[model samples]
Every structure is written in C-alpha cells, then in structure tokens.
Target: MADSITTIGFDADDTLWQNEQFFRSSERQFAAMLAPYFDGDDLMDRLLAVEKRNLQYYGFGIKGFTLSLVETAIEVTEGNIPASVIADILAAGREMLWHPVETLPHVTETLEGLADRYRLVLITKGDLFDQERKLAQSGLGDFFDAIEIVSDKDRSTYERIFTQHGDGPRHAVMVGNSLKSDVVPAIEAGSWGVFVPHELTWVLEHVDEPVSSSRFRRIETLRALPEVLAEISAAYSAA
Candidate 1:
C-alpha cells in the first residue's frame, strides 16, 4: 500500500490537532451552564441528538455547535432558559474557535518526514473559517501541498479531493482517527485507509470494524507512520 501511495491525506481535527477534547470540555461547560433545568447527563444526551440532527443544516464546527447548544437549551428548558446562559454558550463557542491549535505528539516531525516523499494534503471536514484559522495557528500548515476544508468526509468527497489534486485513488492513502470519516470513506472510494487511533475520539465519528478490507490497516501513533510507509516501499521493492 505504501509503495502504491504517492499522495497522503490527513484529517485535521483530531488527527493533527486537539479538537474534539475541547468540544467535550465546552460541552461539559454547557451542561453545567444549564444545570438548573436538566440533569447534566440528560442534557448531554439531548445535546448530542440535537447535534446529530443539525449536522446537515448547520454543518460541522464551533458555530454549528454553539447554535445547537442554544437550541438544545431552549428545547430541554422549554425556552425558559435565561439570555445570560445563551450568551455564555456563544462565548464558549468563540473561545473554542480561538483556542490554540495544539499539534498531537510527533505530528510536526511526522509531516516533515513525509513531505519530501509524498504529496501531502490536509483533507479536513469543518466550517471553513474555523478550519482555516486553526490551520494557520497549527504551524504545520506549510507542510501540506494542498488543503481541503470539506463539509463532509464521504466517498465522493475523497474521490474529488484526490482527483483535484491529480492523485489517483489507487495511489492515495488517507490517514486519520475516525473510522467513519477517514477510514471507511477512503476505502469505499478505492483509496487506502490508515487508521491512527486517538484515545479521545468524538462519539459522532465512531463506526464498526473495517473487517474485510485488505487496503486498510492501523498504526498506533504518528511516530509509527513513516515506518509503515517504509515497510510498504520495502515490501514492494523486494517483490
């Protein structure tokens, strides 16, 4: 797989920088903010449902999440929630957008090593403005030859990104944490999927096993990525 892959696509949020954990933190704050009306657990359940339902309409990222928080507050509390609470939710959303983009362990060095060997791309799904801001702050942005802030991570989306970048799906390898977003779709699109497990993945991105796929594999961390590529190259060379 590594020998065939000339282009490597990375999923930004959790794959590269700290994203979902901050959202989780903000959600905890959100639950606490509305503690007067509903149980924290119940609020979490309700908010998650709202977020899932709103994904199409609001799309992904902080703004959509903030709006969902407001709507969930209204729904669970029957619109009796205070304006100050609404204000606080909006404020929290802003804070999340402006939060420092903390690169994951070995992300910088990994990208640095890969950049010279493959055509690197940042293929992330989120609100454009927020994604762009985070990319700029991440300091690892310069490594990518192309950047894609897509609305969703689907088969067609992966196909289109590879096409636009002039990289055939057969020669592309998509790496990320989410099984649903990064692995499955890339595999379904006829590309290779490399799952790099993250300890704190968002519930929304969870999916079942990639059982039957020969083109799919998992590496424990970013530090292991280069060796995987090297192994692929070596195996193909020996053959």
Candidate 2:
C-alpha cells in the first residue's frame, strides 16, 4: 500500500518571502564601508570565509552575519579597524532585522488554498528572535499549524518535525528554494522534496539538484504547488 501524505513543510526565507536580497544589499554596504582598507571582492571572500567558520559559533541570521562582517574587517585590517565601521555594520544588521517581509508571488494565495487540505508546518533555520520577528511581520503566521526555527536543517530535523507536526517523514512534503537545506535532507528523511528555485539564494546554501530521487519534484513557483501535491498524492496512491 502507498503511504499517505498528511503534512506540508514550507521554508520561509526566499521560498515564501524575500530574504537574501537584503543580505546582498547589506554586503554591498559593508564592502563600501571598508573599501578604504580592503578591495570589495576580496573583502567579500574574506567575509564569506569568516561566516563559514563562525556558523558553529554564531549560527545563522543577521546578527551572526554582522558579527562575521566585523570579524572580517578586523582580520583584514589586522586589528586597526575603526569602531565607527563596526557600529555601521551593526546598524546595517539592525536594518535587515527590521526590513519588510515581502511575500513571494502566489505565496499567500497558495498557502490559503493548501491550509485547509494539509497540516502546514513551517520549518526554517536562523536566529530565534529574528525569525520570530519576520514571521510576525509577514502576517503568514496564522496559516501554519506549527513553526520550527532551528539552527540548521538536516535529515533528523525533518524526521522530528514531520513526526511532531503531522504523520511522519514518509507522509510529509517539504518545499523550499534551497536544494541543500530544504530539499536533500528532507528527502533523506523520507519526505517528498519539492524545489522552488529562488533567484538570490546564499552561496553557502548552494547544492546540486537530486534529479534521480523518486521523491524529488521541481516547480517553478508556489503557484504550481497544489498541482504538484496532487500529482504526488496520485503517485502514492498508485504505488
């Protein structure tokens, strides 16, 4: 018998609303603030390196990103970096924290349509307060049956979330823009992994598509989600 799907897991950043663009904007601002001390591309490379290393220390979100920026500045300048630059970086991070949450095309409509049919669970990774702020600001909070703000996304994370929120990983569908964080791990956890590509995914979140996975489905936008879900259901029933 085919396993029945009962839960739908959605990713917030970029999948439901605009997120990475703000970080990109802030990065350009950060580069300009330090141009006198470092080249733009070189500074960005250093900043990314620090971010990668600092993920274990600071985790994800604007706060960690700002800290990484400061660390990068201090490293490149050999500790002579100005306090004013650091202040500016902190201010930029605050701006990102307060930035408006602009939902992607068809996000609201699609979620509204699916909420009645499935147990919708939001699974996102980032700082707790910032993610909470974004969810409150987005006004999409009510549609979710449960919200999980985790430090990271992985197979075990999906297993736990799906089991708690609905049925189990085998009965869940995880949809998002990142192939790495949102897709691969969820697929490994025994859920359907649906990829909805976004234009400005962060470099660290990059990963190749799992086209050979029977549970993988790629859609152009959230508008196509219901149809995809129906198709998955049909496949499951026929199995």
The best candidate by TM-score is 2
Which TM-score value belongs to model 2? 0.97
Structural similarity to truth (TM-score) of each candidate: 0.95, 0.97
* Model 1 spans > 4 angstroms off: 1-3, 234-239
RMSD of each: 1.9, 1.2
Q: Cα miss at 221, model 1 (Å)?
A: 0.7
The sequence of per-residue lDDT tens digits that candidate 1 reaches over residues 52-144 is 999999998889999999999999988899999999999999999899889889999999989998899899988999999989998888999
Residue-pair clashes, model 2 = 0
Candidate 1, residue 100: CA error in Å?
A: 0.9
Candidate lDDT scores, in order, read 0.88, 0.93
